[model samples]
Target: MSIFKSRVNTNSDTYNKNHADSLAAIETLRSLEQRAVTTSNKRRPVFEKRGQIPPHERLSRLLDPGLPFLQLHSLANYLVEDDNPETSIPGANLICGIGFIKGVRCMIWVDDSGIRAGSMTKTTMPTIISLQEIARRQKLPLVHLVESAGADLTTFLVESWAGSGGMFKNLARLSAAGIPTMVVLHGPSTAGGAYMPGMSDYVIGVKENGLAALAGAALVKAATGEVADERQLGGTEMHSTTSGLVEYLAEDDTHGLEIARDIVGRLNWNTRAKPPKRRPFDPPLYDPDELIGVVPKDYKASFDTREVIARLVDGSDFEEFKPRYGAATVCVQTSVMGYPCAMIGNNGPIDPQGATKAAQFFQLCDSANLPIIFLHNTTGYMVGTEYEQAGMIKHGAKMIQAVSNIRVPKISLYISASYGAGNYGMCGYAYEPDFLFSWPNSTSQVMGGEQASKTMGQIITAAAERRGEPVDQELIMREEKRIYDYFTKQESAFYTSGRVLDHGVIDPRDSRNVIGFALETCLEGRNRDLQPNAFGVSRM
Candidate 1:
């Protein structure tokens, strides 16, 4: 009860006052948090700016309005050890969710660039893995918006050995499973970060702001003595055009997001299955005769196949994918009558084996769920030692495998020359289309009679010269012409008669209607066998 007792009482009184004030502050903070959450809920799905506009808002601008964002890791709460106080966020650096674009829902994962350059902390691996798992389980399209400086140095030891290696295995599995994965390059993306786009079926980028590369210019310079800027290093212009690294090059971030959304819309099963909501057309229809003028009458004269596609698809409804990737072949998604379909056509005068790109295009078609339309007019794959040196055998085989895998509805229209492996690749007898329509002007055969004639002529000349005899040039020419006629006219009749070719003849002006009827008929059959769902496996 002396000086010590008096001091203790004084300290206890002061402690009680401070504790009451702290409790009041806690209640006030709770109320403020509740208000914020309520306000956020009332507001449209807007992204919060941690250090920059959140990925959801960035995606919101890219997608159509009111499309719900199905978040994959909405409740992922984790922290890094000794994390930078100034830059740390509760979820570390990764952000993953599911969202819709024009009602096309897709699983999305974007890096939070504000948090340690969007580096992946140890805890971040599960978020990505979990998202991918959900996407695979639901057969949803997977979209990745990468903007990272690679793995966090502090967490690399724990995450790299235990986190990413197995996680990427799942990513590769999801891709191979045909989940329709797409990657968008909104900003610079490097290292393991770059692989995200590489693994996806389609890669998109902003022309100037987006950058994607296996290694940065600095790293490349370190590995190999070379000089190049960021654009040369990984810019969209370089990757989109020169390297074929990126499929679609957008003018800006907003455009890139839109392109991504458009791509998803085309590939998503939910979107593709619907018959396009456009006004119905007459039963028997065809492209305008003007399309004839659009394509050069001369086979040697190459014109943009896209123009032909534009003419055929609903007015301005054709959406091209991987435009820059396969220069020799064209792959696009468009609606004939509001129904999504994939079109794979040769770009120029065909090659001997057909376009090298044809095989790739065939592979894409085989993997997709929607009906496919083939605008057959390929010369064939390029030949000679050059093609052999290019490993045409392996690449062409890859395409053959893809074509064989197609189980969906397929319609092939031979608008011009459908020769050799090219014809086979374009749903010729080998691929067995549900319906085949040969334009009145179209010719179908194993290979171009003109091309085969040339090769046969050379062999005849060489053998005659080797035997020291005068070559019967006239006889040889006659024989070659005979070979051409047999295949061009006779082969068409034989195959059509045998039911091997499906439908034999169509009018050039009615090519669109021919395709429309074929697709419509096939889709009618499909509906009888299949019932579509809100969420289903998407196109590759």
Candidate 2:
């Protein structure tokens, strides 16, 4: 019963500043998400005219009311197009999240046809792949509200054409792994996109709007001199009867969603096995609202990682692992909500001792079958002559090895700075964490802007001296400034989130709920049994 005592001074000037900065960051994230939703909502008129429900509305109808829907990559592809941020739309023309379908947890992807006719862009493909990956890993049933125009041919690239095959391959894998995939086709799904419904275990198509075809009328006419109508080639009627691609036909979008829900309900997904007994737990001793003040406004300013743990863990009761040795890397055994978990939080750079401690902690968590949550806020492993001599690389490699090989689920939350190997050690997205999220004030990069600029400046100055040439001080300053600005801008939470580096940026207040949901989702995967087959079920 080791309950942590709070050291956070909420009324302090520093705390107030930190809270204000965090609030501003959260507002920025909220505004961006609102812009994406507004972009979709603006198309309501068009969808109404077509007698089809808007993508978001369809999703709302599909999901169980009052249940939490964890949307992923809401601001994806923001400012990734041209340098003009004003014209750029976030969400990559797709709305995706995990939510309950008839009380059964499932992954849902909706084609935002309102934007670019629901076309797949360079930014959107990764989100699609990620959604599929989550479904496969979690064994969650997948439901898609399809109405995409497929890949945008105007900006088509060879790499995109080559990579498109993996989407269908994942569908096959999902079915083979005994995970159900249900698709509700509200509009066109042409070219390679037709395989979406083609590979699903259950497909519900709308009467007039649902169209799935290898080639549309225009393409058909261009390939051969034969003129054809789109509906005749691959309409819902054609697929439901002649082509046998559709399993169910509905009158409209609402009806299609109903059929999709009913299909998931009929899967008997929850009946496979009973979940483990729930544990009784106490809420955090500190207010979650205090989380905003825990993180400093200045990225370099130090804050106690335990302050964060105090507000997230049950009753602020954490059994610290190795309190004296390797104190920089803090490891604690605590429960998030009611679920037991091992958490690794960074108070500073990882020294040789810290790396070894983390590696050992990871193994212990793995052996106990408890999930690990990483609270990332480090510049990276310690450097300089002393650390190098102490086997920093060897110890760091051991930590990476432990993270890579651990069988239990890993969840990561970026609270502040995550730079260099610190990101890897803290389970950055590269390690394929079961779920990774970041606070809007967080930053991820190879190194800090000041450190990078200084290092580069020193290198340039040394190079000039070795070549018997005088270094231009102004030129060096300009180079350093450019490097600093670029890295600084790129490392911001918005930039990384737009690139789909993490799942999404979340408010500090929602940390507990988000982590709890992730734990429950991961636990379901651990408990559920899947019936695997040599090959997937194919359309006959």
Best model number under TM-score: 2
Candidate topping lDDT: 2
TM-score of each: 0.42, 0.99
Q: Which residue runs does candidate 1 get wrong by more than 4 Å?
A: 1-287, 296-298, 349-368, 473-500, 529-540
Q: Write the per-residue lDDT of candidate 2 for residues 381-462, one digit (tens) a residue.
A: 9999999999999999999999999999999999999999989988998999999999999999999999989888998999
Give the TM-score (vs. native) of candidate 2: 0.99
Tens digit per residue, CA lDDT, model 1, 1-540: 000011112135443553344334334323432332343334233222212344545656755676444333322332134333232234435555556665655667887665555666655665676667656654567778877778755546853655676666766777666567788887778877776776777889777667888888888888887866889888888988787878898886667787887876676366434443345432212235445444433344555666566657765455565666656677776667666688877775444234445555555665667678888777765668987797776666666666767777777777656777766667775676766655434456666556667777788888899999999989789878877665544433223312224333433555676666556545643433223333332223
Give model 1's TM-score versus the native structure: 0.42
Q: Give lDDT per model, in order.
A: 0.60, 0.91
**Which residue pairs overlap in candidate 2's backbone?**
none
